[model samples]
Target chain A: MNKKIKQNIAFFVFRLFSLLIVGVLISILGFIAINGIQVIDWEFLTTAPKEGMTEGGIFPAIVGTFYLVVGSLIFAVPLGVMSAIYTVEYAGNGRIVRFIRMMTNNLASIPSIVFGLFGMALFVNKLGFGDSIIAGSLTLGLLTLPIIIRTSEEALKAVPESYRTGSYALGAGKLQTIRKVILPSAMPNILTGIILSVGRVSGETAPILFTVAAYFLPSLPDSIFSQAMALPYHLYVLATSGTDVEASRPIAYGTALVLIMIVLFFNLLAAFLRQRLNKKLKQH
Target chain B: MIETKNINFYYGDFHAIKNISMKMEPNTVTAFIGPSGCGKSTFLRLFNRMNDLINNTRLEGECLIKSKNIYDKSIDVDELRKDVGMVFQKPNPFPKSIFENVAYGLKVNGVKDKKFIAQKVEESLMAAALWDEVKDKLHKSAFELSGGQQQRLCIARALAVAPSVLLMDEPASALDPISTSKIEELIHQLKSNYTIVIVTHNMQQAARVSDKTGFFMMGELVEYSDTKKMFLNPDKETTQNYITGRFG
Candidate 1:
């Protein structure tokens, strides 16, 4: 075979590999959407599950997941953003900083199930929070902390150094320059990171499983201390350990569909915010 | 008035600027001319302590503005910077509107009176000779302006703070000839109100806009004299060679 023919064959192999991944993703999404669409309805979404988790809606699980997401964001966003700022701006490339960065990367590489176990020991048992919404949110926040910090640091670093210099030349102090220039320029990227974290927090079942997930709770959680049903855990229960797994299959599909839709909504929100911020930043 | 006394600056053991002493009178344009990496820009940055941002930098000497040692422990660097403004080689308007770009210094300094900020923004733009072209679109983005206009806007931003000294690091080297002339004319007009220290590679630009000139070579101030004498009758052979286009 000639060089051109060999090159063409190599290119074809790479194309096939790419298509294989895309094909797998499309097939999974197609299966979920097809099986899940039939079971979704206004009544099913708004009401609590009934008849041994086979007949009613997953309203309480939806509300519980919403609370978990909001709670995790509250703990995670500010802490993540501040950590990123300190790492990127305040901390020089010293030995300590490098060690801290390495630790963060290692935390990111740890398995989600390990985070679940840690959360179980720390928040659920030692902290005496038990299997509650607050514990679960905190666990999820921990699970996603590395992602948020790394992404936010990248975002802050992406802001050009010139903007800081311009602000400093005008007699703005470090804080003033960061607040008035650096933060605004990096806002879009930071939002993207937060959105990604949100997706991760919402879809996670392992961390919450041991820390906060309830086997069967149909009512809305009234406070942080209350046990709540989350979408992922509810889906897991319906598909695996339910009294009648065959009858609960549709509910499981619907729960999966709702979880996917929530993530999609957050992704859309991030894109919209990025576009709006870019426009504002560009405006004279 | 500004003066530096036997200044020696080092960037982490790299001797960037050698022993140099020079004085600049208030309300006059003084220009420093040299080739790249000759430390003309470094010497200019010393006035505002802009070089402090770099790590492992050392300075041995006093930089004085109006008889006050700016590098003294008691001197507030931010206050000193406010009094001495700098414009870079490239136009760096804040990612803000024209009005806000000019008003940034005041806002950062805790100036909150709306009328005062608005008045100062207009005055600075007028001083930079960019008012008429952008007067109607004061709220437009600074990036929308042409290269020349953006540089003028940066100048306007520096002027809005009412600094006693204005430093330009090749402010017009990034512009076309017409824009360069405009900046030169603005500098000439500005000298009545502010002391100006400019660094440029363009010999004609130094001769055109500066009252006094300092020629630097290899991080050393080779000659310092009136612009006319330096260009017409230099005392040093190296200065003569440089000005006559024999070599940089």
Candidate 2:
């Protein structure tokens, strides 16, 4: 009886430790959901900001966020995919490959704020893109570069060497093997990486803040030179300094909740894609 | 036909294949009979320059395919590989449909017609003796097949390119007896069209399939002669001991 009691106590302690972290997260999410759901309205999502408040609706921010995701994908994908090819296909465990790998790992661990500062000096100031969507997106692209490279490298690495040998034995050159066999096999995982980058961008207010100065333009961007409002910055302002604290509270929570939902939708999408691709892969 | 002259290989100063010189005739199946780590597979890979992939690996002397030295700077590896096809120990099919697996080479070389690819895929499958089983499921993934079927698919994939020389590195080592025999029969049928060179540790397999045999031991060619002579009367005591149920 004593031994069983001791065992039960141990199990309870372990359960408590696990629940402590999970419980806190769940409670936070619940609080946000409860507080935010009422603010969700069609007008709030579609309408522009009113007066100087910048808290009325997130239309401009939504547009800006979309631009950010698209622009970053354009810049980061080819570079990441090419680097992954070099690392996984041609590179041995030599000094240069090891160095590139080390740099990639280091890049992933870097703080977003530092990237913001770098963007401020590099794109916003030096290159003269100013507080434009392009500047902010390039910063985000830099931020997501290492992630895509590492994830793609991992996906490429996960491909069996037998596949390459098979291709080569079939008389395929280097590019053909990578283009047809390796790239297609690694696609779903690469998509997951890009999706993860999108999630990373949607949550980033700090990187855009320093890089893209608040322009509050009501019109859509006609060129890369225009400054834009990001969803994260808009959410920050709505939560912090709105006209009616009680009324704006809902909008803040709603935006966050929407962001979370968007992220979750993408995550689930990635999971679905991974599942389907894995099934197809198993058939081969 | 391939002829190696005083060939040697090294992996970072460690000798892998030492002074291997042998001539393989057209339309003849040559079995490389050996124990493990005797550099049989290494020697086989030299014909298509497959060994050029290994880091810090250096080759000395020449490997000639039809009097053209494959190691010369003018030699296009892509073209060399097109002429010399290889099948590995383990069956490796691409993550593609059955038809695509066989038609990969043709597609890469820019054959765009749909009907031609289909015809070639069927012809290769028939040549590899797998058309009857997998004909209906041509659109299915290559990995959906069993190990034996996958190996045959690999063979079909190789044959689609119509290479003159085929190198098989322990082609039946991972297969069951029935599947192995099927492969042997397929090899026999293919001999008239392809110069088949195979490496195998199974003495019975080597004895059964090969017209000419080369027994290798410790990175050296011990004996090369008619399969019957090697089995019935070996030149070396070591060859006799290794082959006649004495030692490997």
Candidate 3:
């Protein structure tokens, strides 16, 4: 019943929780940095793919991963941001709006593999997109859409009500406030959503295998109609498809490290943007 | 001039404002003074139809601007908002450059000429008494300003569009004494070019700045008279008791 005793207990619990989170992140970072850097090489990064089960490089896969992420961003940013705008700004608490909200929440929790399956059925087969870069990109786009939408919705929501009031008071229309005030304010968060989705897409294998097809193509796809290779699919091949995997062990760790690095780079970018925005926002 | 006649509003079957009617003169300042939940804000919001966003809310009466029924179905809500600007208790500047924040109104109303937008932004800032502090940093983000500066920026933003009526909801409530006085002086100067309706709980602020003051209590307009009469010679004993700090 002592007040000091209660306060001390609360402080201890807070420190304990903080330590738990920091401990986990530090452990993961250490493991990835230690295991991944040993196999990473400039040759591995620059060299094109080879036919030998042990001699091949992940260049095509890396390139394909880039295309997939860029493609998905192209597909998702406009639609995701627009949907968030509609939900936050335009549509009120109506049945149609509720339905859209319900669907978006449902979509967020569905596994990436399910999205991959959906992509296979819809784009690769039903829609006749085939096992091309476009199909894979579309599938990945679908996979990332929910994440982008949810995170972007949160970002848009976090913009203070005063900003909206200020814009509205200025005689700006609903769209004008959203476009000029709301969206710009929420942009750093939206960019984080895009970066996170890119990480998820680059590391996924099962989805790409079904839609992108695991062919050792000599050249990059010249058109959307052309099939492509990706880093995750190549890792899967070297690890499982009876390739020279004793040597491929380092390659897998190296590839994992590369994926982690790319994700970290984007994460760093998001942090930088958040810091800059916060410094400016604190003045007012 | 803005006027409301026999206005009644309900929120989900609960009466929020009942049979409220008043006329606000042009080129002067009016203050809405009342306890919380007395519908001063609701009444202020009605001028620009900001209550349209509220769910399951109903209205029955006429809100007129210059004798034209604003509630008439054909009236464009967007155009009306352009003429009647509002400011909230807290300062909220866009995460944009000072120039952009001031230019936002002109841009929204289809003014695309960059030269015109630049000139209007300057005039609005000058009108709000914030030009000197921010003139050199027009390109800096509006959010980089201090709290008082942000509030003034908001005023500039509203004045940029040349709105005839300015509805300020406790604009100085969030400011320190110095900032609050600056806003009061700005409001005093602004009344010459724009009709101003300010809502305040501070009796001193209402007495100091308002030409006419409306006292609201329990969703009713208890007193509406010249500020001098309302504060000095009281008609209703309830108004007298309130002014003397008997009850909020």
Model 1 chain A worst lDDT window (10 residues)? A212-221
User: Which stretches of candidate 1 lie above 4 Å from their native place?
Assistant: A3-5
List CA RMSD, all candidates: 1.2, 1.9, 3.7
Better of 1 and 2 by lDDT: 1
Cα lDDT, model 3, residue B38: 91
Runs in model 2 deviating more than 4 A are A1-6, A51-56, A213-215, A244-246, A282-284
Instruction: DockQ winner between 1 and 2, please give it.
Output: 1
TM-score of chain B taken alone, candidate 1: 0.99
Worst 10 residues of 2 chain B by lDDT: B239-248
The 10-residue segment of model 3 chain A with minimum total lDDT is A48-57
Candidate DockQ scores, in order: 0.82, 0.68, 0.49
Q: Which residue segments of model 3 deviate by more than 4 Å? A: A1-39, A247-250, A269-284
TM-score order of candidates, top first: 1, 2, 3
Worst 10 residues of 1 chain B by lDDT: B239-248
Which candidate number maximizes lDDT?
1
Candidate 3 lDDT at B169 equals 93
- Write the number of the candidate with greater lDDT, choosing between 1 and 3: 1
| Model 1 Cα lDDT, one tens digit per residue, B1-248 | 99999999999989989999889998999999987899999999999999999889999988889999999999988998999999999999888899999999999999999999999999999999999999999999998999999999999999998899999999998999999999999999999999999999999999999999999999999999999999999999999988889986
lDDT of 2 by residue, B152-187 (tens): 999999999889999999999899888899999999
